[model samples]
Target: MDVDTEINELGISNTVDEIHGAHRIGQFERLKTSHTGRETLKRLGYHLHDTMHATTHEIPDWISRALKAPIPKNMNPTLHYGRRLDRCLNI
Candidate 1:
């Protein structure tokens, strides 16, 4: 699917969709706008986004980590997601 469609379906912010190409949207519940919520979203988003271009070694590591993590019930959008995208890619 296209970025816009994926963004809409995943409930990501338009700003995140703006990152364009090679990205997966991560969402959190709007009601849980606390530190924990943001942190969890960041980790999930980093994992999802990294999948688009992860190297062979990186892919397995990320997948393993994500598989061990719990699925959150909320669906909220945050502005800092993109800002941390680079850090995730570097990991």
Candidate 2:
């Protein structure tokens, strides 16, 4: 696929859709414990509710490994947010 096509496939548009309001950002501050983590997980658990949908969950086993690896303290927020959101889709 060409670069433009790939970018579109990844859902990166030069502009956000005007029909949508502000994008919601989840801060983990409220998820202080595993109980809270599980509660937060519940909100997303529906992503896999339908087996007849033909789409399967894509779990990245490398995430825990990747997150545990060392990294520079100074990281780009854009890349950080991308990986963080990608991980949520799996969990």
Candidate 3:
């Protein structure tokens, strides 16, 4: 049978449609405007991420330490994501 037929006939328990259907539009922008909500998210300039990139290594020591230390919340962002695009997405 074709993929669509297989999905229709045998995919009932897997819920592929429901998996993709849960996303809402403006999901990222959905944060309510509190002092620390959308406004803080928007203000995020990836400062830490930039700082990480400006260093000599592909990844830095402090970031590795983050696993053990939990990158301090007060650290500067120009430092870059101790991550890939996490700063832009969830900073």
Candidate 4:
């Protein structure tokens, strides 16, 4: 018998399908705008930063640690906003 026939006879196809279905469901659930998604990303070492804002007073400590460069103490709001807009437009 060929490889496909052997896989079918052993029910490996069904097992593989089930695994893919489970993975898809897990991915969908994790993409929601909820704490579960945030926590999952955090566990994977992805820290969120408020790149849209110029003020640094409210930045979380975790963000500082995650960044390679030191977070600026203060930034010009207009410059920050312009940069954000440029990034969005380019993307």
Candidate 5:
């Protein structure tokens, strides 16, 4: 039998749809994580230094809110993390 016939006989056509659906869900999850993970990582203070190096100038609004400070006029907004962390550590 052909592939379609074999798949139908095995009642596995739904499996293909399920796999595609799972892939779409995974894509959405990855997008969400990529967008939100930075803020989450910063909040927990796990790897602030590394993240500062990796981040760009386009600071997301959520990050500013999370940091409870406005983004500076400089190109590298992430540099502010040092002073922010210092204040937090001092308190």
Candidate 6:
């Protein structure tokens, strides 16, 4: 949630992370036409895969709605984690 739009020269949204290395899941329609945009996203996937040692398999189309991305979902780890905590507390 701390991410802000910075002036980008190479990729869409031009995020600070893209400047440094990490790319984001930006506008899907734009990425379809932009080579640099695809590179940015591909790089992020490679790095994440290298760190995790697993392929994503395939991103479901529904994931596009989670636009708070690169932040909110990672912060939670999994929805099940939250559910477990709530169950423990009988909430």
All candidates' TM-scores? 0.18, 0.16, 0.21, 0.26, 0.27, 0.20
> What order do candidates take by TM-score, descending?
5, 4, 3, 6, 1, 2
For candidate 6, lDDT tens digit of each residue in 1-91?
A: 2234233333457446665553334464355445565566577673323342333466666876664445654465575797778887995
Worst 10 residues of 4 by lDDT: 47-56
Which 10 consecutive positions of candidate 6 have the poorest summed lDDT? 46-55
Candidate 5 Cα RMSD (Å): 16.6
Query: How does model 6 score by TM-score?
Result: 0.20
Tell me how candidate 3 scores on lDDT.
0.52
Tens-digit lDDT track of model 4 for 18-80: 889999778755644465676666687766554422343777999978879755665545667
Candidate topping lDDT: 4
lDDT of each: 0.53, 0.54, 0.52, 0.69, 0.66, 0.53
Error of 1 at 78 (Å): 52
TM-score: which candidate is best? 5
Q: Write the per-residue lDDT of candidate 3 for residues 1-91, one digit (tens) a residue.
A: 8887887787565465565555432443343323345445557541222222222446778887776756677565656656546756785
lDDT (Cα, 0-100) at 17 in candidate 4: 75
Q: Candidates 3 and 5: which is better by lDDT? A: 5
> What TM-score does structure 4 among the candidates reach?
0.26
Q: Over 4 Å off in model 5, which ranges?
A: 1-3, 12-16, 36-91
Rank by lDDT (best first): 4, 5, 2, 1, 6, 3
Q: Over all chains combined, what TM-score does candidate 5 have?
A: 0.27
Tens digit of per-residue lDDT, candidate 2, span 8-51: 77875644653233332233323422455545656866232333
